[model samples]
Structure formats: C-alpha cells, structure tokens
Target: AQSVAQPEDQVNVAEGNPLTVKCTYSVSGNPYLFWYVQYPNRGLQFLLKYITGDNLVKGSYGFEAEFNKSQTSFHLKKPSALVSDSALYFCAVGGFKTIFGAGTRLFVKA
Candidate 1:
C-alpha cells in the first residue's frame, strides 16, 4: 500500500516566522515525492519534488523539503512565512498514478 499522510488539517504562522507542514508516506520502491500549493478556486502550483538524490531540496517561494527515507517523511518548510504564502498545501507520491494527501491549509497572519 502506498499513501501520503498530512496529519495537520491547518497550520497557523505569524508573518516572518518559519513554518512547517508535516507529511509522511508509505511506498514499496523509491517514491517520487512532490509538494504543491493551491489557492482559492485555483489550480495547484508545483512547489518541489524529490526524485532521487539529495535529501534537502529547495523550491519556489522560498520553500523547501527534507526527505527522510528512514522515517518515510518529507516535510515542507520555509524560513519566513508570508501572508501571501497562506494557502492550501498538498503532499503527493508519484508512481503508476499520483496519490495526494488530504491537504493542509496554511494561514500566515499579518
């Protein structure tokens, strides 16, 4: 069974502070990991991906993710949160078909 779990339904961060949205997964072979952000009534924007290589990967909007194979986790992070960064975030795994977690709504207060 392959699946991704975003434990948090929502994450609240004060502007300028670092933020993190947790994610964990289960897969048979090496997984194609991805992070995407979605705004109200908009399509998801690709943030980053972990195919195979370095554990730490950086992506758009100053976002990054650390892939922990032992823990089966790939957590999203940012140094400073922005109000504009407040949006829905999703953790996904790619294989025969892409599977997405429920999603985490991030709120960056101004």
Candidate 2:
C-alpha cells in the first residue's frame, strides 16, 4: 500500500517570497508523484508530475518540485510567490488508485 503525507495544514508567505509545501510518501515500489492545486470552490488542477528522469520537475504556474528518492520526499517549490498563488495544494502518489494527502492551504499576503 502507498500513502502520501503532507505535514503542514497551511503555509503563509509574503506576496513575493518563495514558498514550499512538503510531501513524503511510502510505497512498495517506485512511486509516481504529482502536485495539484485547487482554488477556492474549484476542482483540482494538475500542477506537475515526476514519472521518471530529472529529479527536479517543473510544472504549470512557475511551480517546480524536487523528487528525492532516498528521502522518499517530493517537495513543491516556487521561485517567487504571488497573491494569486494562494490556494489549496495536494500531493498525490500512485498509478491506478492514487492516494492524496490532506490539502495544505497557501496564504500569500501583499
């Protein structure tokens, strides 16, 4: 069985600061990791994925994540945060039946 854990319930950042949302996973075999963002009252939107290759993967909205195999962690990052970037983020791991972590809400203030 595979499971995803996001330790943070919410992340607060200044408007232009870099932001990160942590995620870790445990699985039987190699895991496929993904990040999705959900705006208020909206559906989950695919942000990025790490299927294979390059430890660092880039995705929509200037977001990127590092896939650390040894640590079993995939942490999402942004060079600079925006007020518009504030949203609920989810980290998921798996193939057919993906397991998603409890969402982390991002609050970016100007």
Candidate 3:
C-alpha cells in the first residue's frame, strides 16, 4: 500500500529562522512526491514536486525539498521563516492513487 507519514503534529519556529517539516513515505512502485501549503479554510496550493530529477527540488515561496530513496523521506526546508508562512503543510505521495499525510501546522512566531 502507498502511504505518507508526517511525524510532527506541529512545528513552531520564530520568524527569520530556518524551518523544516518532516515527511516519510511508502509505495509499491515509482513515486511522485509533492508538497502543498494551505491557509485557513483554503485549498492546498502547490509548492513543489519531485518526479524523477535531481535529489533537491525547489518550489514556490523559497521552499525546497530533498528526495531520498533509501530513507524514503522528503523533508521540506526554508532558509528563513515568515509569519505569513504560518499555515498547514501537507506532504503527499502519488503512485496508483494519491495519499496525503495528516498534515503539520507550522506556526511562525513574530
């Protein structure tokens, strides 16, 4: 079965500091990894994706993720956090069907 797990329920970081949200996955075949962000009551906005290219993939809002096949992980990172960046982030995996993690709420304190 294909699945994704976000180990953190919430990640709190002060504005201007680097931040990271952990993600791990399980799949039967080749996997497509994606990161999305959502604000209150809003649909997820595509951040980035890793199909089959370089290990490090960059996306919108200065966010980037590294795909590790051996570890089955794709952790999202940013150099500096912003209060506006505070929102719910989701890591997803697509194979036969798409699956999303429970999601991690990021609170960037000002």
Candidate 4:
C-alpha cells in the first residue's frame, strides 16, 4: 500500500515570509511524489513532483520540494509566500496505486 500524510490541517504564514507544507510517505516500491494546490471553486493545479534524479525538484509558482529517501519525505517549500498562494495543498504518493493525503489548507496573511 502507498500512503501520504500531511500532518497539519492548516499552515499559516506571512505574505512575504517563507512557507513549508510538510509531507511524508510510505510505499512498497519506488514511489512517485506529487504536490497539487486547489483554490476556492477551482480544480487541482500541479505544483511539483519527485520521481528520480535530483533530490531537489522545482516546479510551477516558485515552489520546490526536497526528496529525502532516508526520511521518506517530500516537503513543499517556497522562499516567499504570497496571499494569492493561500489554498488547499495535497500530497500524493504512488507506485501502482496512488494515495492522497487528507490535505492541508495554507493561509498567507498580509
């Protein structure tokens, strides 16, 4: 079985400050990790992914994730968070079967 966990229900950050949305995974085989964001009444948007190669992977909207095999984690990070970045974030892990975390709502305050 493959599973991902977003321990925090919500992550609050200042508009100009850095932000992190933590994610941990457990899978049987080589796993694929992905991050997606959903805004109000909108569909999920791809953020970043970690499959292989570089441990540090960068993606859309100034986001990046570090793939740590030792820790079994791929936490999303942004150097500076914007109010517009506030949304629901999902962490997914998959080998053959894909599983999504409960989701973490990010709020960036001005």
Candidate 5:
C-alpha cells in the first residue's frame, strides 16, 4: 500500500520569506511524487513532480522540491514567498490509486 502524510494542517509565513510544505510517503516500488495546489473554489493545479532524474525538481510559480529516497520524503520549497501563493497544498504519490495527503493550508501575509 502507498500512502502520504502531511504533518501540518497549516503553515504561516511572511510575504517575502521562504516557505516550505513537508511531505512524506511510502510505496512498494519506485514511486512518483507530485505536488498540487488548490485555490478557493478552483480545481487542483499541478505544481511539480519527481519522476526520475535530479533530486531537485523545479516546477510552476517558482516552486521546487527535493526528492530524498533514503528518507522517503519529498519536501516542497520556495525561494521567496508571495501572498498570491497562499493556497491549499497537497502532496501525492503515484502508484495504484495515487494516494494524496489530507492537505496543508499555506497562509502568506504581507
């Protein structure tokens, strides 16, 4: 069975500071990790993915993530944060059904 865990329900950050949303996963075989964001009354949008290659993967909206196999962790990171970046973030691991974490709400304040 594949599963994902997002320990925090919400993360708060200042508008200009760096932000991070943590994610951990467990899978039987080689796994595919992905990050998605959802805005109010909107569908989930793909942020980034770790298929195979470099450990550091960059994605839309100046977002990036590090894939750590030994730790089984895929933590999302942003160089600089923006108020517009505040949203519901989900960490997912692809396998059978593509299990998703409960979601972490990010609050960016100016």
Candidate 6:
C-alpha cells in the first residue's frame, strides 16, 4: 500500500523566518513525490517534485524539497517566509495511484 502523511496540521512562522512542512511516504517501488499549494477556495497548484536524480529539488516561490531514500521523507523547505506565502500545502506520492497527504495549513505572521 502507498500513502503520504503530513505530520503537522498547521505550521506557524514569522514573516522573515524559514519554514518547513514535514512529509513522509510509503510505497512499493521508486516513488515520485510532489508538493502542491492551495489557496483558500482554489485548486492545488504544483510547487515542486522529486521524480529521480538529485537529492535536493527546487520548485516555485523559493521552495525546495530533499528526497531522503533512507528515511522515505520529502520535506518541503523555504529559506524565508512571506505573508503572501500563507496557504494550504499537500504532499503527494505517486504509485499505482496518487496518494495525497492530509494537507497542512501554513500561517505567516508579521
């Protein structure tokens, strides 16, 4: 069985601080991990992905993720937080079917 888990329901950070949204996955074979952001009442937007090659993969809006084969984790990271960056994030793993995380809400405080 393949699945994705977003350990945190919400993440809070100061406007200028770095932010991370944790994600872990379980799958049978080589996994394709992806990060998507969703604004309020909007569809999910592709942020970044880790299909193959390179442990660290960069994505939109200064976002990046490191695929850890040992840990089976693909954690999303941002160097600095922004108020406009506040949104809901989802972690998905591709297998026979795509499994999406519960979705984490990010809050950037000024």
The number of the candidate with the highest TM-score is: 2
Q: lDDT per residue, candidate 5, 1-110, as tens digits?
A: 88999999999999989999999999988889999999999999999999899999999999999999999999999989999999999999994478899999999999
lDDT of 2 by residue, 10-94 (tens): 9999988999999999988878999999999999999999999999999999999999999999999999999999999999998
Tell me the spans in candidate 4 whose CA falls farther than 4 Å from its real position: none
TM per model? 0.98, 0.98, 0.96, 0.96, 0.97, 0.97
The 10-residue segment of model 5 with minimum total lDDT is: 91-100
On lDDT, the leading prediction is 1
lDDT of 1 by residue, 1-110 (tens): 78999999999999999999999999999999999999999999999999999999999999999999999999999999999999999999985689999999999999
Query: Which of candidates 2 and 5 reaches a greater TM-score?
Result: 2
- Estimate candidate 6's alpha-carbon lDDT, on a 0 to 1 scale: 0.95
Q: Per-model C-alpha lDDT, please? A: 0.97, 0.96, 0.95, 0.93, 0.95, 0.95
Each prediction's Cα RMSD? 0.7, 0.6, 1.0, 1.0, 0.9, 1.0
**Deviating ranges (above 4 Å) for candidate 3:** none
Clashing pairs in 5: none
Model 1 segments beyond 4 Å from truth?
A: none
For candidate 3, write residues 11-43 as lDDT tens digits. Answer: 999999999999999987778999999999999
Q: Give the runs in model 6 whose Cα sits over 4 Å from its true position.
A: none
